[model samples]
Target: MATTSCDVAIVGAGLGGCFLAMLLRRRGQNVVVIEQGPSIPSAGADFLKPPGLRVLARHGLADLVGRHGLRRDHIRYYHDGDPIQDCRFPDGGFLIRPYRELVELIYTCCAMEGVEFWFGAEIGDIAVGGGGVEELTLADGRRLRAGVVVGADGTRSL
Candidate 1:
C-alpha cells in the first residue's frame, strides 16, 4: 500500500475548503483536499448572501469581495407590506458573486499550484498526535498523513 503525505490536510470541498487549499498552496505548502462530495458545479445560485458575506468579512475577505462582487448602494426593509427602513451604505454594499465561479477559480488555482485533491473520500477517523491531527483514515481504508488537518467539514462536523 502506498501512503501519501502533505503539509496540510483539508477535509471538505465547500467554498472555504477550496479557497483555503489554493491559498495555502500559493504559500508553498504541500496541501491535500479531501472531499466527501463531488466537485463544485459550474452553474449555481451560490453567492455571498447575508450569512456568507459576514463570514467573508470576518476573514479579511472584504476587499476580495469588493473586487469580485456586485455591490448595491442601498438596502430596503419592509414590514407588513410597508416600507420600514431604508439604510444607506457609504462604503459598503450588498456584495453578490456566483459562489460556483469563486469555487471553480480556487479549484483551478489549487490544481495549478499542485494541491492534491481527492473527491468522494470521507474522513472516518482522525489520529491525533502531539498538538494536531497526524493522520486521517478514509472510508476506503486509506490512511493519509499530514502536518496539519483542517476540519472545514462544516457545522455538523465531528
Candidate 2:
C-alpha cells in the first residue's frame, strides 16, 4: 500500500472532471483524477450548447472540439406525430459530437497539462474529518490525501 497527496483529488474521469483537472493544472494546482472505468467515459451529453461552447472557447479548446463536429442551429420537438416546438440556437448553434470523442479530446488536453489520472481505480473508503473529506482509500490499498476532493463522478457518484 502506498500513500500520496495532491492539491486536488477529482473522483471522476468524465468530461467535467477532466476539464476541471486541466484548468486547475494550468493554474499550477496539483491534480489527480480517479476513474472506476478503464478509460475516459464513453457516454455523455452529445450536444455542446452555446454557453458551453463559449466556456471552451475561453479555454482555447473550441477549435479543437469543433474541428470535426457537426453543427446545428435549430431543434424541433414533436409529440404524438404532431409538431410541438421549434428551438433555434444562436451564435453558430451547437456542436454535435460523440460523447466518447468529446471526452477523449479533453482527456488528451489534461494529459498534456500533466494532470494525473488513475484508471480503474475504485474508492474503497473515504475518511472524513471536520466536515470534509480527509482521505481516500482505493480498493487496491492506495491512499490519496488532497486539500480538496471533488465528486464529479456523475449522477451515481459515491
Candidate 3:
C-alpha cells in the first residue's frame, strides 16, 4: 500500500467539503478531498440563502456563483386564492442554482488553488488515536495521514 500525507484530509466532495477545501487551500493548507462517488454529487439543495451567499461574498466567490444563477428577492404565499403573506429577502435575496453546478463551481476554485481530490475513494478503515484521527485507509489499499481529518461526507457519512 502507498501512503501519503496532507495538512487536512476531508472525507467528501460535496458542497461543504469542496467549499471548505477551497477556503483552507486559500489559506495555504495542503488539502485532500476524498469522495466515494464517481464525481461531485448531482443532487442537493438548490437554494443559496443569504448567510451562505454572504460567506461566498466574503471569499470573493459570490460573483462567480451568481453569474449564471437566477436571483429572487421575494416569495408570496396565497391561501384560498387570496394573498396571505409576502416574504421579502434582504441583500438581493437568494440564488437559484442546481446543487451540482454550485459544487462544481467551488470544486473548480479548489482545483485552481491546488487542492487535491480523490474521487471514487471508499474508506476501508479509520485509525484514531489520542481523541483524533491519525490515518485513513482506503478500500484500494491507499493510506492517508493528515494533521486534521473532517467527515463532511454528508448525512450518510462515516
Residue-wise C-alpha lDDT for candidate 1, range 1-158, written one tens digit per residue: 46789999888767788879877887899998998877753444544556566765775555665586787767688999899999765545566677776677667767877989998887788888788787888878888999888888777575
Q: Ten consecutive residues with minimal summed lDDT in candidate 1?
A: 40-49
- The per-residue C-alpha lDDT of model 2 at residue 17 equals 97
A best-first ranking of the candidates according to their TM-score comes to: 2, 3, 1
**Clash counts for the predictions, in order:** 1, 0, 0
Would you list the C-alpha lDDT of every candidate in the order shown? 0.76, 0.95, 0.93
For residues 24-121, write the lDDT of model 2, one tens digit per residue.
99999999999999989898799999999999999999999999999999989999999999999987999999989999999999998899999999
CA displacement after TM-score superposition, residue 64 of candidate 2 (Å):
0.4
Q: Which stretches in model 2 have alpha-carbon errors above 4 Å? A: none
User: For each candidate, what TM-score against the reference?
Assistant: 0.74, 0.96, 0.91
Number of the top-ranking candidate, with lDDT as the measure: 2
- Count residue pairs with overlapping backbones in model 3: 0
Q: Evaluate candidate 3 by giving its C-alpha RMSD to the native, one decimal.
A: 2.3
Model 3, span 1-158: residue lDDT tens:
77899999999999999999998998999999999999998888998989999999999999999999999988788999999999889878999999999999999999988999999999999999998999999999999999999989878888
* lDDT assessment of candidate 1: 0.76
